[model samples]
Target: MNLAERLRRALDAPAPEDLLAGDLIEGASVTDGIVPAAVLVAITRRAEPGVLLTVRREHLRTHAGQVAFPGGRIDPEDQHAAAAALREAEEEIGLPASAVTLWGSADPYRTVTGYEVTPVLGAVDPDLPLSPHEAEVADWFEAPLAFLLDPANQRAIEAEFRGRMRTYYQIDWEGRRIWGATAAMLVNLSRRLNAWS
Candidate 1:
């Protein structure tokens, strides 16, 4: 299927309730219960389809050394989730305005870290040049969307976030370890796509 077709199918399917892993992002100095943040889990159009993922520079202040969708806390100037997601994607990955076309958004998710995150699914041109800002990103990887959504590749792992053990899915791609909130968000996206398709 084409990128648009894949996204169309995903959006058309029935969506599941947003899964909560019990206060996932708690230690950060922010209030709980849904503060606005946005992330772009963008799929690209190419001969071989892929999803864009980023590795944070170990020097960053938050969520450092982890794989993530390019995103951040919502700004007062931001109008909506899609806008924020696109803007952050551009700021973080150097993806241009012409490259991304917004699709539907998934449910709002909360991290134990005090962010009520809006997960955006978008389609982008794979030809765009990408550069991870020196202080923000250490690397970028594009994994095939099919590889990520396949149930065969999914693994359940247990971890303690707030003195509570929770089951989370992990995507171990090549040498990269993709887990935590990014994995959580992808879990929701996979379900949404499954339902939509």
Candidate 2:
């Protein structure tokens, strides 16, 4: 039906107790000595469905100029991964804490850049304005959730990393590249929704 509908349906469907059982950490599979990060898969509450992605500024020291979902590391005082995600998002994008509704946490993802990131899924009202801090979001846009969940639209690209040949999933949308772990997670979500579809 729409973005909100897709998320609602996904959330409403009967899920195993383990699905909502606990917070996930990405350290298990990620390389040793890597810093762990908590990332969020923030969705929009608008009609015709889409997702919010951030384009980091080119001058940053870390992950400089990367396209990422809005989130950062877990705070010491934060209760869980979702809390860290919402807190980081609000701090970076100025999205009011009350505006978000968390769905559930996805599988922990291991990044090539030595980050063990846990992705949290949630939805928010589409009209709320965003103001990013720390990272300069060159732009933000909505891409249909259905488009991302589609397998035919997904593929991988071979690249060299640290002198080793690596494969990364590339999701090209309107010329934006949603690759690596983000693309894989989107693929996972797409498969989940596709079953329901």
Candidate RMSDs in Å, in order, are 3.1, 4.8
lDDT (tens digit, per residue) of candidate 2 on 1-60: 665566557644644332211112222334477666777777776665578888877897
Q: Pick the candidate with the highest TM-score.
A: 1
Across 3-100, the per-residue lDDT of candidate 1 in tens digits comes to 44676567656666655433353343445455689999788877767889999998887788999989988888998888888888888989875688
Per-residue error for 152 in candidate 1, Å, reads 1.6
- Candidate 2 regions exceeding 4 Å error are 1-30, 195-197
Which residue window of length 10 is worst by lDDT in model 1?
21-30
Please give the TM-score that candidate 1 achieves against the real structure: 0.87
